[model samples]
Target: MSFVLGVISALTAPFLVVVGFIVWDNHWNGTAFALNMYNCTMTAIGFLIVSIVVRQFVLEPSTEEEIFTSQKIGGLMVSSTIGILIGDWVWLEGLRLLGSRKIIVVDSLKPFLAVFLGEVFLDERLERGAIIGLILTVLGVALVGLEKEDHNIETETTIECESVGAAGTEVFNEHTVLIEKDNNEQSSTVVVDSYAQQRKNRGKQSTKEFIYGLVMAILNVVLHTFGVLLTKKYGVGMTTFEINLIRFGFAGICMALLSFSLWSISNISSTTTSTTTTMTTMMTTMTMKPAWYLLPDASYSTWRRISFGVVFVSFLQPALTNYAMFQISLALLLTLESIGPLYSLPLSYILQGNRPTFRACIGAILAVIGIIVLSFKGITES
Candidate 1:
């Protein structure tokens, strides 16, 4: 999903450039403001829907004391996500300094940063494979940027998954249990081989979670890319709030449809009160929360965060990221943008805290290398 978003962002870069040109030619600066505002509104709505679903369905009350603890944790989660918004704003600001291509390259390094952050903050350790993978990534990125020609470039999007294992760390919900004891007490003293297998499975699960992150990332990328084209053709006299409002609106509508489907199915099953119906109802309903409800609480401390979230989505991302195309070349922006994954990798691991097996380690390394190679267009040029 991340790779695909990268490609889509790249592919759509030209369209935005043209749009910016057209806007400029016609003196349509106001259009830009419209875009920015629209973008923010839509994104907020989408986020809200997703949040609602998570809170309503995905969560189970963890403990008696958790009601308050959960709110505290929720507060912290919102605070932390503000960091993401700040990171995103910085990313947009940096994009203005760089172009899409370079931004992508830099963003591609996100995994590396994520690893480093994971090590420092999350207690994630890098295996030999990860180190080697990082080297490959750097080499590959250099090669792609310095190279004169593209490699076996394929069209269309593809996604790959890598697991960071136990070394990775992330903030946790107190409600979520780390592990459950097995019924077989005789094997309480686990063997090394079983532990390894468990680690491998855990790593695989992390990969799945990353997929969700990638989905969100890609959607963000595509919307920003499209917004940039619009700005370049028109001009920045307009606010990004409009664009964000529109795009987010579309996203919100799509998510709303999803929510409706879930609700419809839930109501259908709610009519049945058998044990199986009850179980299914619980699972599905819990999972189908309106995404909006996922947002941080409306507490006074969170007001700034909520506002920033709104502005970043509605205005900054659409206008600034697109405006960046004019200042920095698209290639530079892309390079920088590639670093986003690096930012996420280790944190994801820490969040889940699963260890990587030797094989999984090797796979992760190779995958990172592949990602760099894909972003950089291979190492021959470098």
Candidate 2:
């Protein structure tokens, strides 16, 4: 049941992130920095609460080596925080730009990237199956890109204008044209307005944003690969709960200090607009009730759901995933993680009644085959 829960948690983790960001984006128009900070802070608080409760009831003491005084553990915490912070920020930014589906597909490159990173940094030997898996993973990513391109083509809007007295019709595809009809100026005006509307619709497809998202997605893979390697090397003698508490607690403090500093600067800048008393009140409200002040207004139920989702995703998911990480090699672990989309496909189908596209199905199958081959190699070598 624990293993089953871990697998379920792993499969649904991305969806939870996607849903949280979508809700926040829709309601609060939240920045990635704000969301990341809130998530870290909440996770830290949750871990602290759980730790206090467990300490009161359970008396499992840590060894001297497990104490937090060691320089090695300190370095691990610093490096891990950097990796998690940057990785999560860029990942949310990617989701903002590319949406959940595209970002998730792009994330499939993680295992392939991790394989190379492990070989270089961890002195892990790449087996023949890993090499083959890398090829298939790349191929699968390419197919996903193709699907995106097809989606773009399908979304492209074309306007066909048949002028009243003109000999031929003029067609415009995502571009403006000054069409002057011989007899009907009103008709020409209508065509121009229609073309303007089409342009407005097409403006939503931003090539620059898509490219930025793609780069961020790739950077996330690189950072996460390094993080996993660091954890496998230096995460010895620490409980998962201890790791989460320390890492998130440190990050939460840093983020709080940064937020306060920014708020102070902003208050100083706007001092002329408001009296000192009003400024102090504003600052107090922001500090004492940050979430209520910063986040968008929603119903109590909505806020409750959002809070629950964040706790599950930010705290529980990592705890379960870290357990699985300890049980497998970094390379094999990442290879298995690549099958997340395959799990998501069926889950999405069952829950949302959304069918997978043919290309997505093909990509999922390829990724699964690669994972199976890689896992088989790992077992045989062991």
Highest TM-score: which candidate? Answer: 2
How high is the CA lDDT of each candidate model? 0.36, 0.54
Measured on C-alpha atoms, candidate 2 has an lDDT of 0.54
Instruction: Give the alpha carbon lDDT tens digit for every residue of 81-186 in model 1.
Output: 3322223444433332332334445445544544444445434454444355455655444443222111101111110111111221011010000111222332
The number of clashing residue pairs in each candidate reads: 126, 0
TM-score of 2: 0.66
Clashes of 2: 0
User: Which sections of candidate 2 miss by over 4 Å?
Assistant: 1-29, 51-64, 91-109, 130-218, 274-293, 379-382
Clashing pairs in 2: none
How close to the true structure is residue 86 of candidate 2, measured as C-alpha lDDT? Answer: 70
Error (Å) of candidate 1 at residue 123 is: 47
Report per-prediction Cα RMSD to one decimal.
21.1, 11.9
Q: How close is candidate 1 to the true structure, as a TM-score?
A: 0.32
Candidate 2, 367: how far from true, in Å? 2.4
